[model samples]
Target: MSLPIVIIGSGFAAYQLVKTLRRQDTQQAITVITASCGDDYAKPDLSHVFTKGQSANDLIKMSADEFAKTYDITLLRRSRVESIDARQKTLRCNGESIAYQQLILATGAKALVPPFQGDAMGRIITLNGLEDYAASEVELKKAQSVLVIGAGLIGTEIAMDLASADKRVILTDRAEALLPSLLPDFVSAQLYQSLGNQGVSIELGTQVESLRQAEESIAISLENGHDYRVDAVVCAVGLRPNIRLAAEAGLKTNRGIVVDRQLRTSDPHIFALGDCAEIDGNVLAFLQPILMSANALAKTLLGQASNVALPPMMVKVKTPRLPMQLSGNTANADANWQVSASREGMTAKAFDEEQQLIGFVVTGSHMKQGFSLLRELPPTF
Candidate 1:
């Protein structure tokens, strides 16, 4: 029998590759090594579960057993891939050596644990996967008020979801505004105000200096000399790619596991994708790019040479209070943004010196207009 194509990690990247590969060639022997229960769930839904009326279990599209049975894959749940032996084409997992024809690293990113002086640091939680969410669900349900650190995309979205679920949410960041790196001031102001309208308190321009246990609640001290006591704390700072295994294997790595356009790593037999993989110097962690990479890699694995080619995909900010979608550099844009606002929504377009649309942002009811704007925007990947 031929050696199976073994994939490390069972996140969206790995599962998507299996799905894409099976769509064309179902008979290929595939094996998945996952750290968790191997339940297939959308990571993006982690923040929106409250607002979307979903529990952690509800987020799972399929269980590991079901998925493996459906796709004819050898699913190893609750398993970890400790080391990769590129030269020998083997993996040291659970004190066992497993061989593979081709290996793919889909080990996703992990939540960034913010550095702070805190005795109660253990009380703060960071959600990055189904397991994290499942573990935090009980604490979230018991808490009335929550302190959410960071005001970036994930932070802001989780804050809104918490607020919408009737939890008193304090959204804070070291930056002056929410998503300061992703939106213009005017647009951010709109979102800031909208979040306020949704009953979320915004504390910007400062980070948590310390966190202390206050009886049953958590005491949070901000660098701005402000303090608050909340029933729970969630740190939604950001994510750092998982590159330790790949790096230990002697594969090239920078911000993430460096791979070529073909999703091939330094070792020709090893490939990578999703949050852990950086292609062409870009670490694309978004769903669209991950799916594209999976499709391209699927073709490549099937002996069809293909490169990851991404379209201008706009990301929808899941804040129901003031919906928004954007692509390209809205913040620090090379050109000035042509701004327009109204009762329906606001739309900002940025044009280069050549007078071509390079980037854009839309909010409120102007989401439908994003189609045309996205078409005009320059290639991002």
Candidate 2:
């Protein structure tokens, strides 16, 4: 009997790897352990639930039993992994010792909740998974107004969704413009104007100072000397990779669990991918890189010795009013942005010192050019 290959998550990375591996080789014992109910859902849909009219239940693409039967693999749902004994090649999950030939960590990421003063901290919510989305749905039903902290991708999307649903939305961020890390000033300015036109109160260059419970609402104080009362607060600041388990298991970790080109961790028998993995010092929390890593890791696990090579990937910001797409130079460093604005929309191109196109942003009618612009940018890795 062969020992099973164990996967420690059931997200996109874990399932994608399993799907990729099973396509090449059948009859390889595979076991998946997940802390959740093991439902297959598109995580990107979580932010657009309001605008799409999707409930939390609608987000689930596949149930645990369905996934298990479809893939012919063992699914352990709602089981928390206690610890991993690397030397013994065993995992202690829910007090059960399970041995494995290989281990893959796809634990994903967690929402970063910054500490703030106030007794109504419980009213602050962060959406990182299905459970968070479900909770947000419940909260939204009871609230007429929402205060969103952070004007990044998730925050802006949620604000748009809520505003579209006739809810009052106030989107606040410490940065001067929206998507400051991903878009050029001109592109972000377009989105800022678009959101404001949609009745979203934009509060840039400000941070939440505190939250206090008011009569049937939460009162939020900002560092910019502004105070507002809202039914709920959603924190979309960012995500921190879930690396505690890997670090506890004695695996090397930085922003995420350290991995190589093949997605192998410090321990050869252990591997990692998705939001939990930092490959060659790059933590790609996007779907494209995760899929790329999954393919390479699947081949490597099957003795193919594959290495992941990713091209420049485009990030589509799902703001219906603005409809922007950005590719490359998300850091906005060491590049000059040359922007052209018109009634149709705005196109901003980022060029390096060599006068080569390194990144680009397309908004509104010009968003159709996003693919062509992506081709001009250099490969990410």
Candidate 3:
């Protein structure tokens, strides 16, 4: 007779929330509506599955039916939330209306696809979810070489993965270095060289102008004037938060769905987390923040207001060619960092205006110092 708590995603954020909430209140009615197959899998695994020789099916931790039964929650798969009626405390999904005691928007972000000029229908792929990965696997199986656009976290990891699979990989980006937003030139240059040593062709500081269909492969035109014909094309540009439903419902949104420290959106009964949420004017799409938010949101859902603990987060890049660890805030792409490099490894630290330790990067054998440097980074988030 009572409405169930509705979550609008099935990603790690949604899974963790349900797990955390169930720990305190096992009998609470919960429902998850997902656009995908609702399989339980670590999304981060998609990027490096190739290195492990794993398929999309292998990446699945649990199926939708199994997850639903295990958690004792309703799972609506292959469904999309069409709209949200914030005032009515209900949402329309697939032409059906559902009411909720509390609405959690864990919709997550979408893979950003840059605009291309030529015919780029089935030739290009961006792996953001299970289905996308499946589609990419099909393309990669027949392709001998791959062109990866955007040398960010996803781009670099995927390039390394493809190379490990014995595919010729060409990594390109608008920035002069890989992971420009997260690493300084010195740090990225080291990674660039490492990937190069691993047989990856690094194409930096160029824009992809068009994608045309060639006789045997896809023709990619770069703004730098050099052209290439590759068997496959993949884009790892970045992600943009899913804020449409929130914004359409009049919820406050900036870079993401605006939320307080408690993960509460503009509406009292609505909350958001993970890639879709901006908490306290900051949007963090990292794993640690998502886990912290889920734990805090679970407390709030159980009738207690708890704020997520802001700590300097650590991210371990999945490139085995050159292992990397980043701690603290490296959100600024133009940060002036001081770096020290040796054959053993590389270490870079960022400082604030007042000489406070703000961020640092460690790569290769130098990760032994990651735990200590993580402590030195400021909790700016």
Candidate 4:
């Protein structure tokens, strides 16, 4: 009997890959091993679940049993892959050895928790997966005020969500502006003001120095000499790709698990995608790139060589108080920002030295312009 194809995750990438692969080969033996409950849920919804009044149980899109039965695959929930024997084509999970013809590492990433002097580090919650969100819900129920660390995409969205839920939210970050890596100064400033107006206290250019247990709350001291006492804390600093298992097995790794255009790792039989993969030197840790990579990798596994070509994908910020859509390559450090703002909204376009539109940010009614700019921008790959 041939060994089954093993996938080490149950996130969007893993499940979507299985669905795509089954379309080509209906009878292929496939097995998925996940550390979590194996329930299917849109991870992005974790940030705004409070505003939607949805619990972790309500976020499940599909049960593990249903998903496995639909795809004709095996689902191993609450299982951790301890190690990988690359040469033997086997994985050790929970003291059991499982053989695989080909292995897919969709392990995804972990929420990055910044180090600080703190005895109350355990009190800080991070919303990364279903389990984390469940834990955070419990914490929120007992707290009236929340402190959020980081002003990036996830951090900002979480702040907005909490503020909308009527929780006193104080959001702080080390960066000078929100989403410093993704948005221009002017655009970020606009969002900063918008969030502030929505009753979220914005603290830019600040870093948490220490956290200590107060009388009934957590006392947080900032590097900027400001201090606050909050009932709960949520950390949304960022995510670091899960590459330990692959690296331990001698797989090449950089910012993430290194893979070729075909999503194959150093070992030809092993492939990676989603937040865990750095494909062709690009670590696109987002939904669109995951879908595109899964589609292309599915074809490759079915004996057809295919490469993922990602077009300029826009990111929709879920802050209803300040609706925003960002698209194209805004990471070009050499690009210049041409911004125009008014009472209606703000449109910030990025242009390279050659005067070509490389990226744009649109808020309010001007979001309609995103589609046109996206068409003009070049493919990300």
Question: Global lDDT for candidate 4?
Answer: 0.90
Q: TM-score of each candidate? A: 0.98, 0.97, 0.95, 0.96
Count clashing residue pairs in model 3.
0
Instruction: Evaluate residue 339 in candidate 4 and report its C-alpha lDDT on the 0 to 100 scale.
Output: 77
lDDT of 1 by residue, 320-360 (tens): 88898998767864677798888989889977787787778
lDDT of 4 by residue, 1-381 (tens): 678989999999999999899989998899999999998999989878878888899999999998989889999999999999999999999899999998999999999998889799888899999889887787786678999999999999999998888899999998888998887776777788888887888888889999999877999999889898999999999999999999999999999999999999999999998999997777888898899899999998878999888888989987788898989867567789887777778788889889999998899888888899889887888
Q: Write the per-residue lDDT of candidate 2 for residues 1-381, one digit (tens) a residue.
A: 999999999999999988998998888999999998888889999778877778889999998899999899999999999999999999999898999999999999989889999999888888788888787788776789999999999999989988988889999999998988887676677788888888999999989999999978999999989899999899999999999889999999999999989889999999998999998888899998899889988888888899999999989899888887888885566788788878888888988888999888887898888899888888888
The candidates, ranked best first by lDDT, are 4, 1, 2, 3
Off by over 4 Å in 1: none
What's the residue-level lDDT of 269 in candidate 4? Answer: 95
Residue 294 lDDT in model 3?
95
Worst lDDT run of 10 residues, candidate 3, spans 328-337
**Evaluated with TM-score, which candidate comes out highest?**
1
Where model 4 places Cα greater than 4 Å from the true spot, the runs are 331-334, 340-342
Please report, as a residue range, the 10-residue window in candidate 4 with the lowest summed lDDT.
328-337
lDDT of 4 at 194: 83
